[model samples]
Target: MDQGQLVRILLSLILVVGMILAAAWAARRGGLLRQSQTRRIRILDSQRLGARATLALVQVDDREILIGVTPQQISLLHAGAAPRDDDDFRSHLDQARSS
Candidate 1:
């Protein structure tokens, strides 16, 4: 191959790699292109999620539940204790959900 062709190929590979790295960095920083993934909202939905966990909201269940988990702790929530009063994370979760 000609020297010019080799140079162009090398430049193209570098540009592609740089773009991929930039995209990954942006996603990690929660940029407009890519955003951080979280489990908060999925668990916040009442229909999809079970057992209310808020103060303004009433939770009737004996234990707070975490749904849509990896099956390891998904069912464990059924037996776990719910946070109550200021110590309750469910209430905090509600606030986070709003945000």
Candidate 2:
């Protein structure tokens, strides 16, 4: 290969790598790659049930819900007021421990 061809090849590789890195950086900075953050809804916890199923605790507005999730479906299992303070969290923990 001639010097011009080698330089072109090198420049193309660098441009491709730079584009990929720039896209990744933009996504991270823009929060496009992160979970949605909203005051009305938040995922508090989750546990995998099987290969494609999970149980999730989601807080929505003033309430929390227990949801069952699978690759094919989503179902609500329970719903209640969400804990808003340390005392409420402690009480819920105590109730869970007792039960």
The C-alpha RMSD in Å for every predicted model, in order, reads: 13.7, 7.2
How many residue pairs of model 2 clash at the backbone?
0
Backbone clash tally (model 1): 0
Q: Give the whole-model CA lDDT for all candidates, comma-separated.
A: 0.56, 0.92
lDDT of 2 by residue, 1-99 (tens): 999999999999999999999999999999888866666888899999899999999988878899999988999999986558988889999999999
Worst 10 residues of 2 by lDDT: 32-41
Model 1: lDDT equals 0.56
Maximum-TM-score candidate? 2
